[model samples]
Target: MIDSRHRRARLGLVSVTALWGVTFSLNQVALHSMGAATLTFLRFLVASLFLLLGFGLRRSFWQGVNRAELLGGLLTGSLLFGGYLTQTEGQRFLSASLAGFLTGLSVVLVPLILLVLHRGLTRRQFGATLIAAVGLYLLARPQGHEGLLGIALLLACALFFALQLVAVEYYRITTAAVIRFTLFQMATVTALAALVAMAPGGGGLLPLHASQEAWATVAINGVGASALGFMAQTWSLRWLNSIEISVIYSLEPVFAALVALIALHQREGLAVWIGGIIVVVAMVLVSITPPGGATYPQESST
Candidate 1:
């Protein structure tokens, strides 16, 4: 039986996934008024400020940072920034559905990366991942051809996201304080994105003339998705393996479709309904599988 703790972790991850799903539509509105770089910078800036306020300015918070946390945050944060940047750039060239499908490829890439790290998933887990991938393809129904550069960028984004997932699992094991580690990671992403926004040839550093709606969307994404979502993910990594996490996150697009249907009155095709069912089935299979004798490692505390 799954323990209460594991169940709670699963619930937390589900909530995070839902928050992320909501961002799909919210970001569409926000991006209309600001460059991707500006949006990213503001999102992370809000998240970092919120974290700082909650954690406060303590000597240990700033001075006790170990090498592992610093290095891990830099690596993870960079990969995250790359993932978002490339995905945004790719979307400019590819259809929205196709770009989303390509981004979801990270679900497949995560297990592959873990295998290379000598942490292969169980056969059952692998099967579920394949099933989930198929569901994602159907749900996305990706069509049309894009420039090779855009395709390549989306593929790179998937790879970066996969690596970020593995890095989070590894770092949660090594870092002393998950909160501090998350804070540093958020700060790094904010700084990198801000630099890109302010670069010589880039659009201006700030969205000084952004609309109120854009600001509200940014605020929601920052506090809900970036701050709460990321921290919940980092904390949950201690209880769940990377493959499990990836499989669970595959439901994000499913949730997004639901949000669109209910909130925006957007209609989904038959393929989407079938795909949603398949993905949920995959999630059930993974969730019910016994944890014993699995090759994947689970670290309980940092």
Candidate 2:
């Protein structure tokens, strides 16, 4: 029974990773009809609503919110906003494959950040970081000055995401609090994105004037990638170890690259492919080896 459950959990997590991976390409295509801020707002708004209706219908869920959870939600949400905004905006100038590889850098960044915070880093993690840096250089080297701004933004996105993971770890959310905590974070992102959309020249709150493709992307990202993905990961944790989960999650970039090339017809040169592979290797290394060889929870990528 346990083995069967574990197999199911692995499959579920892989499915969740694929959902996340596909979004890189989907959002890139969808950006043709909507502004990044508007897209971000709509995406999270949909996600927040879905989660609310699905899990927040209970009065107990609302009443369970302590001050700490509220604050944690705000902090994590701000970081998430930074991540998605930059990621979506950055995708305008980058191929989905490149964006995936760059975003996956957060895997390496998290351990390094934790190490800086005195969380202790193992030799394996240190080595992986060095390797990832080299991989990044290889990946970005061929692009030269091309998409430099997008590269910078995506790098920032990775940093913000890494910080968000650290913050989530610090908050130590419990099993019961997962739904409530995630809802708060999603709501916060939605509110912030709405504020951005309301600003002058920020585009209107709704993308009602946008194309059907744009609207569909928002729906898929919000309901599938954000809401359902979170639930899937949380569920999988019941059977998967952190290392197993992290390693599986690291395949997100690979899936993104494949989806872009095959499904979206995006093309990349040989150097980019090799560099992307190297980056994935670095991420896998970081995942299989925890910080200081101690147990650490590695969250999914954006």
Candidate 3:
């Protein structure tokens, strides 16, 4: 049997996934008042700072910081920042719950990316994909705030996020270095957001610099979502296969629903409850231990 430490790691991954789910409501709270770009910039800037602190906590975390890793970090950071920005922007028009649910569809997309990369998927993968898809339909309540456009944008966010995950797995960085790598990426993402903020759009929400609320959002999103979340993901993922981790993360929506109900005073109908169950069930069916490709986790698109 797996040791207690390994068991703890697996439990930690579930907890991390739960924390990640809790963050959905927090992000919605932040983005409600801030521009997507400005909020995205702040999140990364804060997450970058956290990353630096994290690096300082341990030696040799950056031992593998070579040119390839640097470039890869930059690329990953850019994609991640852009994907998050898009998701945040989408959230402006969408409900936090739906955004969380739909974006969590990355597990479906992860497997597809694996397939493209020559890693074949199993029957379980296909089954989970279908269940998650059905969950998507249920979560996509018609009366909600998010429309077709927002849905499409969130889906795109999911795609790019999946790419980043596959890339992270492919990069061959040690698990111990994941947070440092995340820091490097956050720095790159912050720089990119700064540059983008400069482009003729009137600062997006940069004018809210003095707004305590905006700054608070930045902290919660950056530290809570990016830095801390990344750490939790790594901590939990160490004990489980990527596939298992992905499946566990597929519960983000359910977690988000609970978070929303408690924190955001958000309500979900029977449809959402039923749909979420379908999605979770599908993930369980498809996420067995046989080891397959073509399925992945969608942490927030996240």
Write candidate 1's Cα lDDT for 100-207 as tens digits.
445656777776675667765778767877897787667545333554566678779879988998898888876646778777778888999989999975555677
TM-score against truth, every candidate: 0.82, 0.88, 0.83
Question: How accurate locally is residue 112 in candidate 2, as Cα lDDT from 0 to 100?
Answer: 73
Find the candidate with the highest TM-score and give its number: 2
Q: Worst 10-residue stretch by lDDT in candidate 3?
A: 293-302
TM-score of 1: 0.82
lDDT of 1 at 275: 66
Best by lDDT: 2
Superposition error at 40 for model 3 (Å): 1.0
- Give a tens-digit lDDT track for model 2, residues 1-302: 23687888888888988888899988987888888999999999999999999978988767756788788888888999999899988898889989988987777777677668876778878788788878877778777565777888889988887787667656543422566777777888899988988899778787667888888999999999887776665555545544456567677889899999998898888888888888888888886753454442433322
Candidate 3: C-alpha RMSD after superposition? 4.8
Give the runs in model 2 whose Cα sits over 4 Å from its true position: 1-10, 144-146, 172-176, 234-245, 290-302
Clashes of each: 0, 1, 3
User: Which segments of model 1 are wrong by more than 4 Å?
Assistant: 91-101, 119-142, 146-153, 264-291, 295-302
lDDT sort, best first? 2, 1, 3
